[model samples]
Target: MNNLIIETLSWGKLEVTEEQIYYFSKGIPGFDEETELALIEMAESPFWYLQSIKNEGLSFLLGDPFIFYPSYEFELPDNEAEELQIGSNVVVRCIITLKEQVEQSTINLLAPIVLNPDGNVGKQIVLHRSPYHTKHCLLQEQPAIDGKDGG
Candidate 1:
């Protein structure tokens, strides 16, 4: 329950507190055997690394999808909500896939990793009824202040 030293493949040795650990009872999709995860905040950025304690090499780049898609929304199925025992305070994060160009990165909008900050429980739930796709372009042309794209 105290600060534990975690050996990660990418970040090397890190001293993380109990509050940074997330427990996934059913584990994550594709990596069902991994139940213990830790959130490693990126340096001076909105992105984070979701690392699997079971496998030091297993890690993911995550970000708050809302930062890009303000209107993005989804409903957690009743069963999943009950599984995490989470209410309105749950934190939702999406995975990012970097392309050859950083501007061409994509985000997985179909499945989101939900974390119950209060209980330290989390789950990666696939949204079958979502209107979004798994690979949404992470970077798009920004609309100009004058109402026209500054292309």
Candidate 2:
């Protein structure tokens, strides 16, 4: 059932689908009131735009943290997992905050958005005592090359 919804975003107007809509029962930390969000794919990129259907101005740039941080792992508490009806095949994504320089972009590892692909239910869960931080730089500074080593 692909129900088209016309929305005006920062980039311009877009037509989203029903399957693309995600419902967050408890809502995200900052945007608690805005529960309905549309997961729009970014053209030619792995990133996705989680736009709020309730508010045109609210949207977030999301990314699959596992793509960049292969070793990244977080345990979902039973309570949260049960609430979202998520099983082992859940999709986990983190919010990406871009800086002036693209290389300086950071992902919010402390909190991750977990979704049940089958049910289309999603929730942003904040880890209670995780080692991850909100600003883990995506790009590492390049090492200086020696001018004498011409070989």
Candidate 3:
């Protein structure tokens, strides 16, 4: 119980110190009770998945929405910003949609779970925008791979 152990692809039993774990207040939708989460690299994938040790079976795929959608941007309502203490030190991230094919994947840019990595505080704020969807398809075009072909 000394360190937060998260299973990862590259680093086995990804040990995250208590100081490194972030607390998601209000948790993800339909999972409000799951407060604590540890972010670890998705084994052999470009995404980072949040693991809820308390729930065991609960976990979500997360990533920098901007990584895929460089133009991706959103505003957290005043209430959410105040609740999360999203000061200048916080970082914003979104959950990516899981697809059978990697190219068909999409990130939830409309609702991002902003986190204050330094303070271990977080909240998922929804963006009431029509241009973006909760399930936007990723990679509209086939991205060129320099070395390995698969994503």
Alpha-carbon shift of residue 86 in model 1 (angstroms): 0.7
Better candidate by TM-score, 1 or 3: 1
**Order of all candidates by TM-score, from best down to worst?**
1, 2, 3
How displaced is residue 84 in candidate 2, in Å?
0.5
RMSD of each: 4.3, 4.2, 5.5
Model 3 regions more than 4 Å off: 6-13, 42-46, 142-151
lDDT of 2: 0.85
Alpha-carbon deviation at 31 in model 3, angstroms: 0.8
- Model 2 agreement with the true structure over 27-117: per-residue lDDT tens digits: 7887789788888889888799899887778899999898878889988999998999876679888999998978879999888999887
Error of 3 at 19 (Å): 3.3
TM-score of each: 0.88, 0.88, 0.78
Q: What tens digits encode model 3's per-residue C-alpha lDDT throughout 38-110?
A: 8766667657777775755667888877777888766677887788776788777788777898887877877
| Residue 136 miss distance in model 1 (angstroms) | 0.5
- Predicted structure with the largest lDDT when compared to the true one: 1
Output candidate 1 Cα RMSD. Answer: 4.3
Better of 2 and 3 by TM-score: 2
RMSD of 3: 5.5
